[model samples]
Target: MLNEEKSTEAVSFDTEMSVEKAKDAKKTLKRLIKLLFNQKQKIIIVLFFAVVSLVFTMTAPLIFSKAINVIYEGIKNVSLSGVFNIKFDVIKELSLLLIAIYLLSSLSNFIQQHVMAAVAQTLVLNIRKDISEKLSRIPLKYYDTHKKGEILSKISNDLEKVSDTLQSGMMQFITAVLTIIGSVILMFSINWILTLIAFLTIILGVAATSIIGKKSIKYFTNRQESLGRFNGQIEEYFTGQMIIKTFNMEEEATKTVETSNSKLYSDEKKAQFITFAINPLIRLMNQIGYVLVAALGAIFVIQGRLSIGLIQAFFQYVDQASEPLTEAAYILNSLQAAIASLERVFEILDEEEETPDAANYKTISNPKGNISFEDVKFGYGKELILTGIDLEVKAGQKVAIVGPTGAGKTTLINLLMRFYELNGGKIKIDGIDITKLKRGHLRSLFGMVLQDSWLFDGSIKDNISYSREASTTSEAHQAAKLASADYFIRTLPHGYDTVINDENSSISQGQKQLLCIARAILANPCILILDEATSSVDTRTELEIQNAMDNLMRGRTSFIIAHRLSTIKNADKILVMDKGNIVEQGSHDELLAKNGLYSDIYNSQFARSITAKAL
Candidate 1:
């Protein structure tokens, strides 16, 4: 994907840019809510606990007020020169009730938190599953056009944001709304004046939160975008570390990272500053409301218009209500950020998947490997890479394609493998149009060994048997021995069980090529594809690999993309491609006799080899 970079920009721009509009906020929110509703059982449990918790919490203040009133009345009577007596039983009962209320409140709160935790984790788990499944269905062009870092960022970073919101922020939002409602009712029951004063804070908080939230949407969106760009640079730069170091471009690479990093910092700062500004401003308004309520409460108590106990209860209500009011701003910001994240995640989900495999599709097993390309025309983008190409191959025929870079050598193999659909014309295998065949069935007919030699982090045995898992261990061992990989495997730490990865230097380039050849050998497909399979190895190793490839290709139709003309000298047929069309076709010697492009490339390579041998 980094190889597709064409612009002189500091780093490649994400194709997803400009799609994260504030307008999608509504749709994202609705979709998220719909996802939550899907977990109705858990949500119901959470809601039940929340109600119970709120009930217990609201009861505590009333009980405390009663106890305070009892004590105050007793003190007043005693101060009036009466015998000092207190309702000790009532005080005891009230104390016990308050303790029970608080304990129950805590229990309910714990239950709700526990249930919501499950809801949040489960929701994220399912979304990840959807994301994973969606990735498999999308066309290869998406990967070729889009930056890998951005793809990874959406999967990891954006999901984390959504997860964080659902985990705590969601519950906080629900509880905040509930607590505000209950506290307001109780506040009004005590005194409308104090409730009104408290509401001044709410009004101010709402106005400030609404304004800040709208402004921060773009900031958060930009923050994620900037992070995505930075991630792209990191992914590309690190993956290309070998090239960078070989060319001594460390400074240039660092500059790329720094450029993207600086942009990320600038955007994140703005997003964070705006998101956090709401809390303090709202809290300050709350403090002012608190002062006004407290002063008025004191004056009312002195005038005997409101009891000390009731005013204290009113103050408690104010604190309870104001708490949510203060958090309203923060929660709004979290929701907005989460929505932004969801927007990006949904972009992946909403991508146009590869046209579905047709219903009642055909299957091919043990195909005769008769392949024909009829006026095949294709392109990655608007510009065609391959145009009006026609070819015919009989069963078990050996075909070699040769060309310089960008000459459509690899693209031909890609089209043959059905990695990309043809823009025009039809490709037929054994006289059946490939479009009618199931993709899995079509691909299973061929085995491929690329020059890069891909191997996942797994046992060597697994790597060899990757193409055909149904192959027996004995078969894998035989394949390894045939490809000349068995000797190397035995020399390793764990022999056949030795773990290897793409980056494992323990296996030399030639050895990795051998393992890949072994994999192709194990599959035993009706056709084979060799894409510069021996180009990276030394001449000695190249000879060994060529022998293994010869064995694999024997009696099987094969298409080989060769850079060294000498390697394909014995090829049954050679197809010379320039630009996108086949310019020449014949046996190696027959094509060289023409003294055209194929002859020129071969003579140049031959001259180079002769000179290197002389040196």
Candidate 2:
């Protein structure tokens, strides 16, 4: 008994140490408990049925033992047919009672499992929905720093792990604990000495489990991280498969995948080996305990200090008591894996979301295209991308921004769209500070077309009409015609009805850009931001796109970020930037006559084109 107490204390200490080392595991467990607590009513119902089922299950062995005792006594004191018939009648009654109890126990178990499954699924659904909503609210910086594949793995794989654990592990854990307590009580009632003996031996098994479980936890955590890395690599490789093939780096990509896979295998193997080791050691201890109990019970029976029924009951109770301990090995492993997954999920949930609007925020119901950046300053982290800027544009004017790569060209557009908050200064539209306006309302005033054209799996009409909630076929056709995409689109088998599952698979890059431009044309915002809008097309296609853009920019304030100086030669004003500052701003002719940075860039491009034509 003293050994058993000390052993329990050791296990407790080990558990505390493991938890201390794994702060994330502890936090995740607490969060999961909080989530479960929200389903109190369902949990209470499950517990009720589980307890009832456990009672019926535990009591059956006692009744069976009693029946055995009765049979033994009857056979030993056989007198005649009259005695035998009376004993038989009593045994028959006990058997019927046992059968009824077993049926009730099974029914209770069924109900408990049914209710738990429902609760688990509901919890999973809500979690997934919350994650989806969270993705929208989180800052764009989060996506920039994190991989899409890793985030997706947490949403799908991690949540599935949590769901599986909640469904089976919760009920199993509750039942195991109840069974251990019930079995212990019955064992003591039969014989306190044997009960003590059983406990002392089981404590050894528990101690082994605690030690092994502690060592395996780190490996389990590593396995989950490796899985995330592996998934991320797969996503990157698949998305950039064309680049890899072009560079002939297929072997290198395979090597990268294999490295991640090998790491996962190593961690998984360690965790599983340690977990599987516990069961056999426990089984060995259990067999040893059975031998001790039988030998002691037999001696006690010879001295008439123990009854045959109790000896039989003790045998059954010994098995029942140790069963939970053996199953604990498996349960602990599953829970560790689930907790690891939960930590990843909670990490995302705990991230700082995008800044929300203040109380009494302004709304932009009818916005004019006038925009101003007053001494604006911004950065990624601590390094400033745009040091300082002051710019103003009137409605219906075309402004061009040109700079070398990484001169904060894209960063300017990002700030305008409110994808990233400015570190300092203010951006205003029509004399109202945009910082005071609701982001959704502010964004609705502008339309954008980028170099990379994005279209999801949908029909051509659906993709073109995506900007409007309801657009007629004729409206879509007009938008496509304006962008010069109608000719090729109509050449397809189904015309506007043709589905575009893979944008690059069927359509050329230029055609994809045309479709994007048509979508933007359909949106028809008061302001337009075009980033390398015609860079993907050939010269002929570029001319068509420029003509279409000219029509689209008729009365809209437009900001064009372009590398090809020829494309923006007719802009109302061109802002030449270098090192995050606008070096010069003027008409193309004025800048050219000035012979400044813009002139140099334009002259170089002209020289290159002339040289190519001569060749």
TM-score each candidate: 0.95, 0.94
Alpha carbon lDDT of residue 56, candidate 1? 87
> Residue 530 deviation, candidate 1, in Å?
0.8
> How many backbone overlaps does candidate 2 show?
0
Residue 568: error of model 1 in Å? 1.0
**Cα deviation of 558 in candidate 1 (Å)?**
0.6
Off by over 4 Å in 2: 1-22, 80-86, 502-504
Error of 2 at 437 (Å): 1.2
**Candidate 1 lDDT tens digits, 253-358:** 8987888788889989998999878778988888999999999999999999899999988888888888887676788898888888888999999998877787
Segments of candidate 1 deviating more than 4 angstroms: 1-23, 79-84
Residue-level error in angstroms, candidate 1, position 131 = 1.3
lDDT of 2 by residue, 313-396 (tens): 888888888998788767877888888888878878889988887668887777778899999998765667578899999999
Worst 10 residues of 2 by lDDT: 1-10
